[model samples]
Target: MNSLKGHPKGLYLIFATSTAERFSYYGMRAIFILFLTQALLFDKELATSIYGSYTGLVYLTPLIGGYIADKYWGIRRSIRWGAVMMGLGQFLLFLSASMLHTPGWAHGLMYGGLTLLILGNGCFKPTVSSLVGQLYTPGDKRIDSAYTIFYMGVNVGAFIAPLACGYFGETGNPDDFKWGFLLAAVVILLTIVIFETQKSKYLLSPDGKQLGVLPDARQQALSAEQAKSASAGEQSSRKWRNLGILAALALVFGTLFYLWLGNDWVSVGIFTACLVFPISILLDSSLTKIERERIFVIYIIAFFVIFFWAAYEQAGASLTLFAAEQTDRVIWGWEMPASWIQSFNPLFVVLLAYIMPAFWAFLNKRNREPSSPAKQAIGLLLLSLGYLFICFGVKDVQAGTKVNLMWLTGLYFIHTMGEIALSPIGLSMVNKLTPLRFASLMMGLWYLSMATANKFAGMLGGLYPEAGKEKILLGFRIETMYDFFMIFVIMSGIAALILFLLSKKLRQMMHGVE
Candidate 1:
């Protein structure tokens, strides 16, 4: 029995808690915009802005969450509090969702609900991600594989949430929408209960037993290694005192620079990160040559990943709306829900994530496995092609009319193909490149790029002019939406080419670290 127990009980606890929370989050998020527009009668632009801001804030807060977890409350207690906040948030969301069409009260409830959710997710996201890191031993090979498995859990929850909950969210029956919100609340409550029940078995001590000391076997060994390295002329640990001031400086610098851009503080801060952190790393001489080179390659990979997400994120912002108000969902006299279209990316990730590793293994054996950068470049190209299909397909439909759901479906397939090539691999790359000391921080930085990309996607999505006459190609007139897709395709194609040119040099920089 002991031999079978290789992984920590804490890891399973994290998974269970995360799955329930993701279910609740995605369940609501998948349909949130449509709920705002259709149910609350907000203007399209206002609703889009609201949704964009909500999601952008969701990604942005993990910086604070990670900090608090590392310094004070720690993952287990933080997650416990997070689960409560989330449950409350879901109930508030239900209140809003149920009363959405009920005039002035609805708007107040909506704002309150959004606030609770934003705060709850802030606490939840970073603690969970860090806890996953805590579960493995130092230099454990299973660690990376473990996260990949956990990543799959996230997508699995994401995949199922929309389809099952989306049906209720947008059902023709009014009761179903209310029921959906209520069900979301229930899911969050259950998550809280489950975690509480298991906490003693897993995380009786949320913080380490010793103040300012490491907790697990992994951290114990890590401290020993650090001692040896320091004896061998490495400098003493960068004390906690310096990190806060540095991070504060970065935050302040980022804030001042981006506040002028828009009201979107998150959008500005993270783009500034994509600029600032890598530069700061370069200027630091304390870093090992290996660390500097590895981080440099990581930055280039992050850049390409940014391009990939800018296109993929369209599934929620522009693409979902297009499906709802525009796409001809009446196929065989059945009206498919627009939010359901959002489900495909997660669905594909769940089914195909495992398969791709095997495919890579086969390709590696044949000496045909493309490098990570090459795979990501290919992902960008495929995403570009997906946008091309959408650009053309939108044109093939009647003006001011809904297009076929099949077009969206086809586009998702292409997006998924691209995702398989790059998405999981990107996580693996980040984990590989990041030094253990800065592991959590680097992961936070990678997500910082995602946060920015998401915001940028929305900002650019808002750029599709409502009344522009667009160009035609292949006997189809490209509307504003199509033109947008074309722009993305061209943008990514150029990026992919540039990255491919630098691919060899960047690979050399990695020095086989990955």
Candidate 2:
């Protein structure tokens, strides 16, 4: 128990489960774009579109899964069923890769596989995260440390997946991609076995009660009423009113995003959901003023988070392209696979994970630690700096010459620091601020922000400069790699500054939680 920074045994159990689940995900993701463009003969634009839509939907479905877990399936059952779906999804991807020459079957099977993955992730992601928070009593200082340890567990898989998957799938021969997908499927099977066998023994509350049991609706409603006095009729009316507002906002946002995104339904759906869900949470009749304000903090931080992830997630698209097309990957005349570069950020996270938690704890003990939102603002700042650092590396390179690999390694290192500041802290903040009844739902909302950011990431990746192809955003041209990288610098930097200004108020809203 002391091994994971003095966390509960259940935390490590969750760590194991999440490690295997992320292995399945990041393993497949490490090679997914390559599969689309190389084996299926799709162009870069089409492949990025598919990648964006798939990743976006993967986060978006957590809303559904969260609702179910909160009301029906409960956490443990959700994990098991979700794992099965993801395992099946990976198997389908393996079949799709195996039949790459048969374009019809390959395309169909790929879509089928991606659908299961999206739905499955919806079920798996939020519940497991909520489980981590549930392992400790509320207001436990170690919650942050526990999540950091869990985050390292996640990165452990992320670190290994690319090395394994990229090696098998990114070989010059297209047919070999199936082996990577097969390995992913196998990992998901392992995920199921580990969680099912261990959950009863280890996934328990501090007082020794079995956790993740089905939620009691009447008890939840009564608890909500206790938080704020509201008659049932008034609550019903408020719920309807919120639903109506959500519908109207969705329609308006859907139209705007669809127009801006050029008829992409995926972008429209993601953006609309991101805008509406938090507002829906705010309008809940049962939330006290304090609860509502704290929830607003989650919303504010989540908005900035979109900027961070949109810039960070270039790892999958434009960055991968950069690694493949512009980075020097030779070691003694043997070229490395581009996808292996995906492991670097996660590698940095695993290396720095323990150090980060202790650093924060030291500051906390000294009464000098920043609030959650401030730390996230710092994350955005570091993200911008990371891109700005890399901008110099590519500024003067000739069209055909590649930069050294250390440039990417340097960029990933800085970005990993930013991720450490933002991602796990955000998870812990959500856990600390939210009411118990809304735990999974709020976590789902957190992932919904990622859904929007990933869609934006896809859109941004489309702006990657191609030879003789003109790309423009907000009247600015993207012609050089430096120009493209600077976009993130400016975008994230401004967001960080704005968030810094608001950090004090957001901390006030937390109302002593910190």
Weakest lDDT window of 10 consecutive positions for candidate 1: 208-217
lDDT of 1 by residue, 1-514 (tens): 2112466556666677778888888888778777776777666556666776677667656655655655566556667777787777777777776675576777787778777887777667766675565555445656645665677777777887888778877875543565666777888888889877776667422243321123222342354444565443333333443455568778877777666676666566666766665554455444678888888888877877777777687677677778877788886888888878778887877787778777877988999888877878888888888888877787645558767677888899888888878766676677677665455456656666666667667665665435543444445454556665776888778877887788778878877754
Q: Rate the local accuracy (lDDT) of all candidates.
A: 0.69, 0.90
lDDT per residue as tens, model 2, 33-69: 8888889988777788888889889989998899899
Prediction RMSDs, each to the true structure: 5.2, 1.8
lDDT of 2 at 338: 93
- Report model 1's TM-score to 2 decimal places: 0.82
For model 2, what is the error of residue 375's alpha carbon versus the real structure, in angstroms, after optimal superposition? Answer: 0.6
TM-score of each: 0.82, 0.96
The runs of at least 3 residues in candidate 2 whose Cα sits more than 4 Å from the true structure, single-residue gaps closed, are 1-5, 216-221, 224-232
RMSD (CA, Å), candidate 2 to true, equals 1.8
